[model samples]
Target chain A: MGVLMSAIGFGIVTASILAVSSVGFTLQFSVTNVFNLSFGSVMTGTGFIAYALNTSGVSIWASMAIGALCGGVISVALNWLIFGRFIRHGISRFGMVIVTIATGLICDNTIQAFVGPTFYAYNAQPGKAFNLAGMLLTGQELIIIVIAAVMMTATHVGLKSTRLGAAMRGLSVNASLARACGVPTRRVVAVAWFASGVMAGIGSVALFLDTSTFAATTGSQFLIMVIAAAVLGGVGSAEGAVVGALVVGLATEITAAYWNPELKDVVAFVVLILVLLVRPQGMFSQLSSERTAVG
Target chain B: MSAATQLYLATVSVYICVNVIASWALDIQFGVTGVLNFSFVVFQAAGAYTAAILSLGPSSSSGGFQRYVGGWRLPFPVPIIGAMVVGAVLAGVVGLVSLRRLRSDYQAMVMLVVSVIATIVAESQTGLVNGVAGISLVANPMVSLIHATRQTQIWIFVLFCVFCMALVGVVMYATVYSPFGRVLRAVRENDRAIEALGRNANRHRMQAFVIGGALAGLSGALLVEFIGAWAPNGWFYPETFVFFTAVIVGGRGSLTGVAVGAALVGVGVQQAVEYLPITLNPSVIASLEWIITGILTLVFLWTRPQGLLPERRRRFPTPWRSDAPELAERSAATKGDERG
Candidate 1:
């Protein structure tokens, strides 16, 4: 019973961390139709930025905000400077994936050079650990859960009630149609990229808040998890990302707890392949993609 | 130039020759056939590992630094042949499962997963190629018989690489011009149409993948023999992209273009690193080089998609359509889809 409880606790925290990135990644993929492999690079960059801010004696909250803003700006810049040109030239989608990957490599290695190849520990005071139903709980982990929930609610509300969010939904479904309808498709795409970037930054911050150290490969390694969550949850659906995150997060943590810890990541990879092989379109893509209009 | 300089040039020539073959094989797969083979390097690694274990004689518990499978003493040429076979068999198996009808993006992702999985398995399973510690192949295959100096051996190696390159070039030339090449090209352009014509498109792709894998394996086998060591660190998925970048930056489907791109990326970049002042820490310098390589790859793809040397279109004399009835109908169907 104690093992089960702790495993469940592990699942929730893992899910919360995954949700932050998966939602952002799904949104970017849906709108741009380009799998921005550089998303991992951006995540790592935001992590470093947060580390720098924290080291300079800023509060954790302030550091997170700064990291998010920097991520957003970087995303916006990449769109304007790099991806925008490729789309304009009518490059093949397959080619674009390679382009993104190479760019990600460049960004990752450049940051590695700057960081001197050593891992950085974001020095934050560890809050006291408490017991909840025989499961040890950290205050930071609990706060991350709150952050994920609040962010999801805000995202849900934004999509349903706001004009910008509605435009985003329209553009994602059919860019040409959205453009024909005078929806300012390019601007919507830029905004979506920025929002996704911010989400990735937040995810990075949350992860480090729990682990206390960051490396160049941190985001890229987590990217596999983010991708798994995004795909399992159903592409382009925020709700699906959260639920998918919970499923994968729990399965991985429990398997690690019960089975060999070294094989935990292998379990996740196996699940991803199985899910993809069984259902390529996604589990939750029930309604039309256009249903985002009413979301 | 001095004798030492001449010797260095000969050694570098061999390096360029081997890499060029590997790069061209990758170009044919990715450039002409449009398969994103992120595991390209691993195929080569497979060849290296196979060749190393087969030739290493026997492993002692303490004297040798690593433990591995297939501790047999074999002749040099035997391992090279074994390397090619290893690549073909592995490629065939991987192609069947991964190349099943799926979205291209999904296919690429699966390939990436395959490479990542292979890396982990290779690193973790100590019995497999001695795990991360790696295995070193005995370098001097003919030192006993040839009785040549180091300088002479280097020249001999250079000639060997040149010979391999010539063989590869001849084969590529034959393939790209043959009837089979035409079918491969047609399938690459449109798989469904070629399949409708009763040609197994997937089979053709599998063949291309296998051939490319074999070539990659050959390159690896040769490289490991020259370097005298094989490590898990030798193969990374990103290294595959470096080859991809070369293919793209050199016009795809053009041999000369691949060669040019190979020189610029494979040799030019490495040479550029050599010229940099040794002011910073050594590791920092190495990291910077990789970052620059990555940035160059991205910039080339974004700004110059056609590459430095664009593919020149060949004009072949059109043969009269003897089977006009089927050809006309098939073309019409494809045109209709595009219109829709």
Candidate 2:
């Protein structure tokens, strides 16, 4: 019972990080409809930015805020410079996917060239562990959970209440219809990218803090799990991302606590593949793809 | 030529052969069939491991250094054949699960996920293929069979690889140019239209997947046998993009083009990078290679989607109605579906 409770605690922390990143991922995907394989690079970039700040004696939280803003700017710049150009060039859907892949490879390798294969860690501390009901969590993990809750609430309210949110949703469902409805297509899309980047920054920092050490490829490595959570909940849905992250986070931690630690990730992947094969539409996704649209 | 130069040439030739086979395998799936097989390197790794385990002595026998399943003391041809079979079977299993009526993008993500799963399992399970350090010191088949000097044995292995390449080439020619090839191309063009004509497009894709898997396995088996090592580091998911770049550069659906592409991209890029005037870090050089590949893909996609040597447009002499003389050239830019 004690083990399970601690596992749940770790799961919550993991879920917190995943929820931030996946929501960022899914939201941009919702607006642009491009599966940004390079989103992980944004996380890595922001993590390093925070690293640079922390190493130079800046406070970690302040660095996080600045790093997040940089992440937003970087993501928006990537769209404006590369993705937008390719889309305007009128590449096929298959071509678009390939183009994004090329973009990601370029980004990842560029980072690799500069950083080499070395691993890095933040200058901040994990602080003291607080035991709450059997689940022991450090100060950092607790802060992360609260931040995730706040971010989720903000996104939920923003999407539900704000005119900008309505325009974004409108664009996701039908771009042409939304344009006809006078939604500023270009502005909303860019805002989505920015928002996604900010979330990526926060998520990557939380993840790095929890994991302790990091590297250039860390974001891409964790990307598969982020993708799994998003896919499990259904692509392009923020609420589903949270649910999916919790499910994945708990399943992985519980599996580790009970079974071989090495196989914990394997269990989460098995669930992903099964869910993908059995239900590609996912649990919470409303827009059925043409392949799954029919009876 | 010096003996060292002679040995170097032979090794390069063997590498060329291995890459050509692998690229053709990828071409059949991605180029001709339009299946986004992002987990391609996994098939090659599977074959390499299969060959290594079959040929190597039992893990507990020689100093008990490495641990893995199925360390049979098999002879020359058996391990290579075993590798191909295992590759096909793995492909079949993966295809059955992923090749359903899902969206193409979704299918691609599944392939990526599968690739990640394979890597995690390989890295985590220490007993399986000796974890990260990998299986090494795999005896070249020629060294054991023929009693000769090391150079002579290596030359013999090179000959065998060339022979295998020729056989695979013949098989590729037969499959791609035949009526079956036409159907496969049709499936890539529009699967819906083929279904309307009473052909199961999904089954056709599965067939391509299995065939590609076997050939990819053969390539890996040959590579491992020559290089004498198999490890998780060599088969990461991003490695698939290298093959995709080869197909795109060489001209998809063209056998000759793809072989030329495989040689140029796989061999030529590394050689070119080596000759750069300024000294640099090894890791930086690796990054440069990828960046160049990424750039090359973008440039080719933008300018010459048909490639330098485009797929030959077959001419059907329609004397009854001389409307069009040859099949239309489908540029990679706008060849297949406009949108998924």
Candidate 3:
């Protein structure tokens, strides 16, 4: 019982990180219709940016904010410079995927060359542990969960109320129709990329804090799991991403506690595959229709 | 030539042959069939491991330095054949899981996930393939069989690799230019149209996948037997892209083009980059290789999607009526291709 509760506690923290990143991933994908494989590189870049700031004596949270802003800018720049150019050049959907993957490989290797092959850690401590019932979690973990909750609520409310959010939603549903209805497709897509980058920044920092140490390849490696979570819920739904994160988080943690810890990821992947087998369109997606990439 | 030069040439020849075979396998699946098989390296790794275990003695041999399942002391050709069989069987299993009626991108994602899962499983199961340390010190079969010096054995292995590549090339040519290959290409262009014409598109994909897997296995088997090592690090998911780049640059669906592509991109770029006077660290050089590969792919896609050597477009006879007397010379000019 104690082990299970602790696993759940750990699961919540993981889910918090995953929710941020996967939501960012799914949201941009929904609007742009390009499976941006380089999203993880953005996370790695932000994480390293935060690391530099934190090591330079800035507060970690402040560094996270700055890193997230930088991530947003970088994301926008990538879309503008690379992805947008390829899309405008009349690349096929399959070709677009290869383009993103190539972009990811280039970015990842460039970062790898710059950073060299070494592990890095932030100066911030995880802080003291707090216990509730049989579950125990660090102060940092608790803070992450709180931040995730706030972010989730804000995103939900924003999507429901804000004009920008409405434009994003509109663009995702039907790009041409949304353009006809006067939604600024380019601006909304850029905003989506920015928002996604911000979430990625937050997620990468929290992930690094949880893992305690990381390398250049860490973010890209973790991306497979993030993809699993996003695909499990459905590719384009923000809410479904959150739900998928929770399920994946819980499955991995519980598997670690009960079974082989190293195979915990395998367990989460199995859950994803099972879900996909039963529901090919994912939990929240309707029958997916082929749509040309908009932004 | 000096012994050193001879050894260098032999090693280079072996790698070129292996890469060419692997690229041809990828061309069949991705280039010809349009299946984004992101887990292609897993099949190659499977073949390598199968060859390793089959050629090497039991797990208890050599003071138990490595532990793996099915370490039989098989002779010469048996291990390579075993590798191909295992590769095909593994591909069939993977195809069964991923060849569903899902979206193309979704299918690609599933294959990627499957690849990550395979790596995790291999790393975790220490007893299965001796864990991350990997199986090493695999004996080359020629050392025991041949009554010659080390150099002779190396040359013999290189010759064997060339022979294998030639055999694979002939088989690929027969398969690609055949009527069945036409169906595979049709499936790639439009699966619905093939289905309308009374062919199961998915089944055709599976067949191509299985055949490709077997060829990949053969390449891997030859490679491991020559190199004498098999590890998870060498077969990571990104390794698949090397072959993809070869196909893209060589022209997909063109066997000869892919072979030339495999030689130029797979062997040429890596070797040429190393000769640059910059003299960076080994790791950075490795990173540079990947960056160059990525940039090369992008440039090729932009400048020439048809590649350096494009797939030959087959033309059929457009029968004209005898009434159109003036069009006789024009019809002769638009000659049909020698596809067969």
Candidate 4:
């Protein structure tokens, strides 16, 4: 019982990080319809940037801010440059996927070229664990949970209340229609890219806080789970991503705690496969009319 | 040429031949059938392990250094056949689920996940092919039959690889010219129309997938036999992207193009990087190679989507011929039906 409760606690922490990344992923997909495989590399790059700053004696909070700013800039550049060119060339969605994969490879290998294959640790002392109701968590983990909750709430309120958020949602639904309705579709898309990139950057910092050690390929390694969460939740739905992340996180942690640790990663994949098989449209997808064809 | 140089050339030749076979295997699926099989290396790894275990003889009671099933101590031909069979079976199983239901993008993601999961399993399960250490010390087939220096033996192996490549090429050529190939292309272009014509599109895809998987297995078996080892590290997910880039650069649906692309990208660029006189770290060079491959893929995708040699249009009998008009009419009617 104690083990189970602790696993749940760890699961919530992981779920929080996954929610941040997955929400960013879904937001990008919702607005741009690009799938954005390079988001993984962006996350890793920002994490490394944060690590470098922290090691250089900068405060962690400041490093995170700068990392997120860089992430946003780079992500916007990718959208305005590479993806925009592909879209202009009339590349199909599938073609865009291939392009993003290429972009991801380039980004990952570029980082590896500079950093080599070595891992780096964040410059932070381990905090003491706090136990409450038989569940154990560290100070950092508690802070992460609180930040995730606040972010989720803020995003919910922003989307429901703000004009820019309304414009973003409208663009996601129908870009041309949104433009016709006097919404600034292009600006909204740019904002979406920057916002998602910021989310990815912050999420990477949280991930580094949780894991402490990371390598150039760390973000790509976590990519499958982020993709699984976003797709399982409903590709365009942020709230659904949180729900999907919770399920994946709890399942992975519980399996790792009780069963073999190595099998934990496999649990998310199995769930993804099951979800794809049973409900191809995902949990909260609104676009049921679009059927996928092979060509 | 120096003896050492000759030996190196022979080894490189063997690899080139193996890559050609693998490229053709991928061409059949991704090129001809339009199924983006991102987990292609998994099929190859499956074949490699099957061949290794089958030919490695029985394990000890304690299961030797690496634990695996079916230590049959099979002969050369038997292990190769076993590899092909295993590849086909695995493809059939994977295809039944993914090809039948999922969209193309989803299928790609699922296969990627499967590849990652397979690697994790292979790395962690000590009972399966010795975990990360992988299976080594694989005896080369028919080594006893040859009485010559090591260099000469390598040349002989190269000859054998050339023979295998020719055989695979001939088979692939036959498939391309056959009516079945036309139907496969039709399915790729429009599966719904193919379904309307009273044929199962999914079944055709599965057949192509199984055949491609068998060829991939054959390539893996040949590669492992030559290298005398198999490891999880050798068959990473990125390896599949390399093959895809080759197909794209060569020409997806063209067999000859696949050969050319494999030669250029798989053998040429990779080997060229090794011989470059750059004074950089080896890791930097490796990363540069990957970056080059990524750039090549993107360039091809953006500018030359059809590849270096676009697929040649298949010629049919002229309308003056007795049966040509009727066949043409039927095709036109099918197209009209689809558009309507």
Top model number, lDDT: 3
* DockQ versus reference, model 2: 0.57
- Which digits, one per residue and each the tens of the lDDT, describe model 2 over residues A1-295? 9999999999999999999999999898888888888888889999999999999999888889899999999999988887776776665566667777887788888888998989999998888999999999999899999999999999999999999999988878888778888988889989999999999999999899988999989988888889889988899899999998998999899999998888877788789788877787765887545311100
Better of 1 and 4 by DockQ: 4
lDDT for A50 (candidate 1): 89
Chain A TM-scores, candidates in order: 0.94, 0.96, 0.98, 0.96
Task: Look at candidate 3 and tell me the lDDT of residue A126.
Answer: 81
Q: Order the candidates by DockQ, highest first — what do you get?
A: 2, 4, 3, 1
Residue pairs in steric clash, candidate 2?
none
Cα lDDT tens digits for candidate 2, B22-127? 9999999988898999999999999999999999979887577889986998989999999999999999999998898777877888899899889889988889
Provide the overall lDDT of each model, using Cα atoms, as 2-decimal numbers: 0.78, 0.87, 0.89, 0.85
Q: Candidate 4, residue B294: CA error in Å?
A: 0.4
DockQ of 3: 0.51
Per-candidate DockQ vs. reference: 0.43, 0.57, 0.51, 0.53
Instruction: State which candidate, 2 or 3, has the greater DockQ.
Output: 2
Docking class of 1: acceptable
Evaluation by TM-score, superior candidate among 1 and 4? 4
CAPRI quality band, candidate 2: medium
| Candidate 4, B-chain TM | 0.91
User: For residues A80-175, what per-residue lDDT tens digits would candidate 4 score against the true structure?
Assistant: 888877776766666678788899999999999999989888887657899988789998888888878987888888888999889877777777
Which pairs, if any, clash in model 1? Answer: none
How far residue A253's Cα lies from its native spot in candidate 4, in Å, is: 0.4
